[model samples]
Target: MPVDEAGAKAKGGRKRLIAIAVVAVGMLAGAGGVYWYTQRGSADHAGEKQAEAAAAEGEAEGGEGHGAADADPTASYIEVAPMMVNLRGGGAQAKFVKVRFIVVAAEGKTDAVKGRIPVILDALQPFLRELRPEDLNGSAAVFRIKEEMIRRSTAALGKGMVRDILIQDLIQQ
Candidate 1:
């Protein structure tokens, strides 16, 4: 039998080239998948480390219930401000609002959030002063201030540093 050597070699070379291309593409895809997985794993590990550090700090801060002297007794105190809320009009009688609340650090956070309380208070002072009894027409202005205080506390504390804002006394006159 006669053989077409040229055609045979061409077909074999084409098949070999196709096989090499397929293998290279698969390898590249696999490498890309591995890279993505590694990056995602690193990010998850970093988050876990942050969480662990936070938990450890919480454990260190009077969490073991060791001594009363070391405990944060100031956690009981609340700052207060008594201000008048003027309405939009000049003739209307303004309402007097007495506000008091305590802010505490979030879990595993230091007292640095307290240091920023001044900023939070500054944001609050104007908001409270500008309030109108009409604004509290729904009859829950105290709740509103508490919510705003928590939000401001969080902002001052860098997103999650404030645990809560306990409203100690709210008197509307």
Candidate 2:
């Protein structure tokens, strides 16, 4: 009877070992599938980028492209002097952010926008001073800041004067 019991125990152990091996194989297969899926996605993304680059190159060579006809060849930019403003909510140690930007003007509106630089700065100064350190956290923050600046510039210079604001430098200290 003892011999029979020992044989049964050996069979049970063997079954457990088999189950563990099957589970390990399944986990490895799942990992491999995930890796393959991620690699395939990146490859697809790379292909898309390459196609875009080719399209851009074709446009550069005078191919009929989307929005190329409407693009202005004489677009002008007005550079803003760097300004540093203290950030809000900086407890004891004063925090400041410095930014230099360029204002994109509408077609034939470069001088108009340049003339309103002081007004634009006046509109932007208070807005910049009110910004907290936390407000400049990520890329989204930068986009928000740009949009706000555009809005302010538009309000200051009237409609169709400011097209965009290109942030040349942003430093926080």
Which pairs clash in model 1?
Answer: none
How high is the CA lDDT of each candidate model?
Answer: 0.57, 0.75
The model with the greatest TM-score is 2
Write one digit per residue (lDDT tens) for candidate 2, span 26-135: 99999999999878856764554445444434433335432232255766778899989999984876878888877878889998888889999999999999998778
lDDT of 1 by residue, 48-138 (tens): 4444444434433433442122355544333434434444435344446656555655555545665666777777777777776455433
Stretches > 4 Å off in candidate 2? 1-71
For residue 37, give model 2's deviation from the true position in Å: 42
| Model 2: per-residue Cα lDDT at residue 121 | 95
**Candidate 1 — which residues are off by over 4 angstroms?**
1-90, 137-139
